[model samples]
Target: MFNRIARFIPVLQWGRTYDRTAFSNDMIAALIVTIMLIPQSLAYAMLAGLPPEAGIYASIVPIILYAIFGTSRSLAVGPVAVVSLLTVSALAEVAEQGTAGYGVAALTLAFLSGAFLALTGILRLGFLANFLSHPVIAGFITASGILIAASQLKHILGIGAHGHTLPELLSSLASHLSDINGPTLVIGVAATAFLFWVRKGLKPLLKRLGAGATLADVATKAGPVFAVVATTLAVWVLNLDDLGVRIVGEVPQGLPPFTLPSLSMDLIRALWLPAVLISVIGFVESVSVAQTLAARKRQRIDPNQELIGLGAANLGAAFSGGFPVTGGFSRSVVNFDAGAETPAAGAFTALGLMLAAVALTPLVYYLPNATLAATIIVAVLGLVDLTILRKTWAYSRSDFMAVATTIALTLAFGVEIGVASGVVLSVALHLYKTSRPHVAEVGLVPGTQHFRNIHRHAVETVPEIVTLRVDQSLFFVNARFLEDLLQDRIRPGTDVKHVILMFSAVNEVDYSALESLEAINLRLKDMGIGLHLSEVKGPVMDRLKTSHLADALNGRIFLSQYDAWRALSRGGPSTDAA
Candidate 1:
């Protein structure tokens, strides 16, 4: 009972092992991550079309909740770029931005997502994430990165623009070009260029300047903080806000506010699908990061437990005056690299954020929105990898089609459409491929028990016997295909007297497929041809034993293809098999 309870509350297990060394390491890592997350939390909230404080609120309670329930030791939970983009997309459909309705809808979305995720975890349905193929996910993320960057261009240019799709954003930006503010544009461009340089060159330069590796890494992670400070100071000292430089003015202070999401059925019905999608995407991304980090330290990450953790975090967000959030890849990697020892690092990070909320809210009033836009642009651009298209294209045509369609649709339409299409496309492609499984004709190699495809290798075969290798499991979708294939191959032949099906690759035989197999056996028996099966897997054999097909088979089942060959050949003359 305790173990079961501890699974739901992971802190109980890891807490016993916590020592001074772990505490010290976690505190240092938390301090560094907290420094990085402050500006990030504020920027992502803006990206989600929420007040800057919403982002801070998201990072605080979510991090603490995940620390108590999450299984990963290093994963940092907060408002991530992709989830933020998804949040804004989902929220825009329900209410206008910067309104009470918008805030309520955001909370409701987070609540619904949390409930769904927690229920899924309780049901141990983590395998459902497999339905979203990696190729499609890669495509969606790549497209989302492009969309996020484009969406932020308005703030970068100091103009009013709003759109969810690439064309809409470009058109909006084009229409507003005449109203671009010069000082805002200057800060945006400079901050963007500097951030790019810091990401690529600063670590190497700092290392060369006699800084230790840890110092260089810490300094590199502080790049955005430096940008925020410099830009905010510049705006404050030079009074750029008066000259049309937009600022993140008058952010609320203190910790996250207590609130409640709406319970309207209409609102729930409207937001459920989007909430489900967000939960699935967030879960997949978080598990991936957790697994990757855990592998480095030989730790374990329970996916179902991760769902519970994330669900708890989102539930925290829903009641804390924030939007949807998840484990951020960049922040988690920073946490891991900074020598975090347990989820306690995240708790400490939450404490740091709480302190910032109390003491640091006034400092960012002069922080230019252009700088935040620049920060978002630099951060999300890292997620845009167009090479996935080329890579998928070169690997599998079907995968290429799914990925290409996802990217194209995401760019032309919005994120919701793009992800929905990607899921449908992936499933369609899987069914298409599975419905036409490969069945190869085989012949025995001259001097061994091995069998090879007749067309590919020089092999020996008897004129009266034919052997086929089934390459896929038999199921309802492809059962008819397999039946038709066998019937077509065994035409009113002149010399074929025996047929053997090599079941080496057949892992399943559903009822529909079993019926098809029975029909095939009866037909073969009527044609005066013996039918046989060889090398069936254990579980498949067990399933078949429950049916009458084995007893009604026209010919005996053999343990191996070679055993069938030896029994049926009767020392027949061998020739080149075609």
Candidate 2:
């Protein structure tokens, strides 16, 4: 009982073994992650159309909650770029940005998302995330990266532009060209270029300057902090806000406050679908990062418990003046690379963020929005991989089509529609391929018991016996196809008296397939032919025995195709016994 309970509350399993060494390691990792998270939290909040402080609040309570419930030792849960975009997309539909209603809608979205994830976890439906194929997911993320970068460009240019799709955003940006602030553009461009260089060149430059490898890495990870401080100082000294350069303005300094998500039916009905989308996308992204980090240390991640962890984190966000958040790829990688020994590092990081929230809010008063936009641009650019198109195209055209369609739709429409279309396309592609399963006509190989595709190998076949190997599971969607293929293979005057289905590859037979089989058996019987089954899987055979099909089968069920061949071939057993 205790072990079963511990699976749901992972902190219980790790807490008892906590030690001084673990504490020391976690504190160091916490300090590094805290420094890195501050600016990102602010930037991602801007991305979500929420106030800067919401980001800090999100990073605090949610990280603590996730550490208590999550299984991964290094996953850093907080506001991420894609989920921020999704939050804006979902809430922008129902409420005007920057309105009280908008914030309420965000809270409601977090609540709905949390409830949805928790319910799914309880139901053990983590496998549903797999319905969105890897190609589709890759396409969605790539397109979303492009969209997020485009969305942040207005801030870089010091102009007002708003849209969810590429065409709209581009048109909006074009119309605002005359209003760009020169100073803001300089800060944005220089900050963006600096951050990009820091990502790729800073560590090597530091190492060449005689810094140790670890120090170089730590400095590189703090690049955003450097950008934030420099821009804030420049803005403060020059009074850039008077020159039409936007700043973060005033952010509240204190711990996250107690709050509640709206429970009104009207808000719930409007936000539920978006909430579900956010939950799935967030869960998939979080679990992917967690599993990857866990694999490096030869650890395991329980997906269902991860759902609960993320769910609790979101619920914590909902009640703590925040919005939907998830495990971030960059921060989690930093936490792992910084030598975090357990999830307790995340909790300590939360404490550090809480201290910042209490005392550091005043320092960002003059922080230019352009600098934050630069931060977002550099962060999301890493997610865009156009090479996926080339790779998928070279491998499978069908997969390429799914990926291409997802990217195109996401760019043309919005995130929700893009993801929905990807899901539909993935399912459709799967059905199309499975509905026309590969049915190979087989014959006995010379001097061997094995059967081979007659068209591909030199094999012996009797004039009166026909055998086919079904290469896919028998399910409702493809049941009729099997019936039609079998009908097409057997001609009226080919002297076919015995038909055998090689079942080595068929792992399942659904109700529709069983009915199809019965219909085939009756049809063949009326034509004075016997239908036999060979090498049926044990579970399938058990299911068949429960139905009347086994008793009504026109021919014997052989343990192997070779047994059927030996019994039915020339100078063998009689037809009825065989």
Candidate 3:
């Protein structure tokens, strides 16, 4: 009973083994992650069109919930760039930004996403994520990174621009070029450049200045906090807000507010699809990061349990006045690198964020939106990798088409359409390939029992006997394909009298395929040709025996292809078929 309960609540399993050393390490990691998450939460909330405080609210309950139910020791769950962008996309459809309806819709989306994830976990449907191909995911993320970076330029330039796609964003920015505020532009560009420099050069400079490696690394990870502080102080001192510079103003200073997501049927109908997309994308990203980080330490995570954990976290967010969130790649890496010993680190980080929500919230009142935009711009730009296109192109044309189509559709249309199209295209590509399964004609090689493709190998064949190697499972999609191929290969005037199908590679024979095989048997019987089966797998043979096709077969089933070849060769000339 205890083990079963522990399986569902992972923290219960790990908590008994917790020690003092773990406590020390977790506290240090928590401090580092808390510092990193504060600005990120605020920035992502703003990106989601929520008040900055909502970001901090999002970071708190979600982390604690994930720590309690999640399987990863280092995965820090919170408002991520992609999920936040998705939140904006979802809420935008139902209500105007800054409206109460918008905030309620955000909560509803989170709840819907959480509900879907929890249900999937309960039903053990985590394998559904595999249907989304890696190339498609890479393409979608790369395009989303570009879109996110472009969307932030409006804040950087202090201009009004609104769009979900690349072309629309670019056109909006172009039209608003004349309205760029000089002060905001300066802060945005300077902050962006500074953050970039910090990422590339600051750690090395700190090391050169006699800082230890750990100190330098921590300082490097805290680079965004430095930007926030410097810009916030600069605006506070210079009164840049008076000069048309936008700032994160008046963040609510308190514990996360108790709230409930809207239960309106209309809102649910409008947001449910987006919620499902968010849940799938978020779960895939989170599991990937969790698995990668766990691999580094020789640990493992349960994917289904992770679904439950993330579901619980999002549900916490829905009830706590926040948007949808996930395990962010960057923050989780920071937590891992900072010496986190367990998910206790995440729980500790949540405590720190709660403290920040109460005390540190007021400090960011003058933090410039341009700096947050700069933060988001720098963070998401790292996710953009167009090399996947070149890699896919060099490997497979079909994969290249999927990646290219996903990228183009994402940039041209939006996130929802791009992802939907990628999934559809991936399924279509799979079906197309499987529908025309490879069927190779084989002949016996001389002085050996082996049979190889007649077209590719110099082999001996019988003029009156033919053997075909079916390389794929026999299913409804490709059942007719095999029928047509056999009819074409064995013409009316040909001397072919016996046909053998090598089923060594075939794993299944569905009902439709069984019907096709029966049809092929009847047709061959009409033409005075015997249809045989060789090397049928045990399971497939058993399935075949369940039907009348096996008894109705015109020729005997052989245990092996070589046996069939040997038995049939006694009655024919061993010359290669023309």
Write model 3 residue lDDT over 1-578, tens digit each, in one string.
99999999999999999999999999999999998998999999989999999999999999999999999999999999999988898888889999999999999999999999989998889998888888888898999999999999999999999899999999999999999999999999999999999999999999999999989998988999999999999999999999999888998889999999988898899999999999999999999999999999999999999999999999999999998989999999999999998999999999999999888888998999999999999999999999999999899899999999999999999999987887788788888889999999999889998999999999999899999999999999999999999989988878998999999999999999999999999999999999989888888988888899878989878888887887786853332111
In model 3, residue pairs whose N, Cα or C atoms come closer than 3 Å (at least 3 residues apart or on different chains), thus clashing, are none
What C-alpha lDDT does candidate 3 achieve relative to the native structure? 0.92
Ranking by TM-score: 1, 2, 3
Q: What is the per-residue lDDT of model 1 for residues 1-578, given as tens digits with 9 covering 90 to 100?
A: 98888988999999988899999999999999999999999999999999999999999898999999999999999999999998899989889998999999999999999999889998999988877888998899999999999999999999999789999999999999999999999999999999999999999999899999988988899999999999999999999999999999998888889999999999999999999989988998889899999999999999998998999999999999988888999999999999999999999999999999999999999999998999999999999999998898889988988998999999999999998897798788878889999998999999898999999999998889989999999999999997888788888855888999899999999999999999999999999999889998889998888898988989878788888898788843332111
Candidate 1 segments whose C-alpha is farther than 4 A from its true place: 571-578
What lDDT would candidate 1 get against the real structure?
A: 0.92
All candidates' TM-scores? 0.97, 0.96, 0.95
Q: Pick the lDDT winner.
A: 2
